[model samples]
Target: MANTSADDLLRTARELFAVDGYQATSIGHIAEAAGLSKSAVLYHYASKEALLDAVLAPAEAGLAAVLHRFPQASDGNRAEFVEPFVDFLLAHRLEASIFINQGQSLHGIPVIDRANQLVQQLAHAVSSEFGSIADRVRFGVALGGAAYILAAQENWADPDDEPERDDEVRAALVDVVATLLTTTSTGIAATRGD
Candidate 1:
């Protein structure tokens, strides 16, 4: 029984979860995948739920870092703030797929709660910049919608299926997000004035 650290367990868990999903993946499977015993896996993560949390921690940290980088923007620099998110999604396509596909089932978990809190913070920060609750909601919704679109596009335009179109897909995502931001801002402003 080779000793493995918590970080090693978490890394293996992330890879497995990304491939098999949180619900489908098991502790034994993770341990086998990591080349450690089940007890070693349990030592790092007590349960499947905990393992899921450990797996998502890095993504949560990455998102937090991105949010911190652009807490607010009065000059309509939302694109800059959004770029990191796009990069993250594209870089971790399978993990992003797992998140988009299975996040609803795990939304009640503490890790997911923390992730939502960060999202709320992002909305609040954007609201503070815009000075309106409506703006915050609109911005948040718009960002979410853009993310959904990009995820769909990425899934449909798989690199293995359409290798030459990868650059095009990326460009389309940027254009779509920018358009969504512009439209959402305009709509928010119009509704607020009325």
Candidate 2:
């Protein structure tokens, strides 16, 4: 019973945070959505921040794992990293939405800060290999774009109703991101006459 209620609180909090933004959401809102008393929600999470922390913990760990797999800038192909990163975003869409979209507003909170740090690590690892500003921007657009696209899907697509759509989206995102990140710099320089 305790575990089930706690799970409910976490799920409700994540959905609310993703859709409504963390700053706009309140404990009362979470309690009402979870169909529990406000005190019951507090009993499991202690505070709104605590609830956010709980909801974000799995995502934090997942990001850390992704970072661990590719800790530093690589001289090899980026497809290896891009695939897992996209997988991470897909696996944790709600959590990714909350952190990626709401991160700037939610700074100073330790959990958010920790997640932000991991994101920085990832950016550095992936972008450092590209010396040109264009390649780096490509890196940002490809990764950030994929994250944003996945986050935006929550607004309209019900995952339960379109279960296979995720798989299709995942394949296309991986291909597009990898292609964007791997585009030849010479082509860009030629076009720019650099």
Candidate 3:
């Protein structure tokens, strides 16, 4: 059995899902988008859910890849963790958005379970990399906050809106993360009588 047909259908389905969203997109739309007949689309995907799962597979793989890239605790300094993690986030921004924003539709999908496992592994990696529970919590809060800000500005904001300078956003995000990490580290050290 040729995998080409299924691959084409899934690629088209992902484009449609990105543009129109899951609830609004249809099998017919994907078929037309792919320049294939509706029957051809059905033959490959069986259903929209299957297509969604196919589309999400790369994102799951990406998450696993990022988790694997996380540095180990022996490296020292929590700041070392931020750059690579942020780089991963930026490099795969679209995949991250699809996973975070559209993940609700993936309930019961096997990829969702894989993605969750990746997230758990990432959390454990963070804890180990930072070498303190406080550092892990602080890293999570700062990272989550940065993600929210970027998502809101990039995705929620109007596409026609004047694009802010990328440097400015990067500088601000770095400052915010650094400040949070510094403050948290200080507080944790103080609590430990250091």
Give me the candidate number with maximum lDDT: 2
Writing each residue's lDDT as its tens digit, candidate 1 over 91-182 gives 65544555555667768888877767776776665455554555555565555655555445644555766453556756766666555454
Clashes of each: 0, 0, 0
Q: Between the candidate structures 1 and 3, which one is better when assessed by TM-score?
A: 1
Q: Please, what are the lDDT tens digits per residue for candidate 3 over residues 1-194?
A: 25786667776776567556777899889888877888887776788877777787776776676666654423355556566556655554444555555556755666666666666676566555456667777766775666555555656666888877667777776677766655556566789999
Would you list the clashing residue pairs of candidate 3? none
How far is each candidate from the true structure, as Cα RMSD in Å? 4.9, 2.8, 5.2
**lDDT (Cα atoms) of all candidates against the true structure:** 0.65, 0.83, 0.65
Candidate 3 worst ten-residue window by lDDT: 70-79
Q: Which residues of candidate 2, in runs, are more than 4 Å off? A: 73-75, 131-133, 154-164, 184-187, 191-194
Superposed model 1: Cα runs more than 4 Å off? 1-12, 33-36, 91-101, 126-155, 158-169, 185-194
The TM-score between candidate 1 and the true structure equals 0.65
Can you tell me which runs of candidate 3 are displaced by over 4 Å?
1-25, 32-37, 71-75, 102-105, 128-161, 165-174, 177-194
**Poorest 10 consecutive residues by lDDT, candidate 2:** 155-164
What is the alpha-carbon RMSD of candidate 2 to the true structure? Answer: 2.8
Clashing pairs in 2: none
Error of 2 at 83 (Å): 1.0
Ranking by lDDT: 2, 1, 3
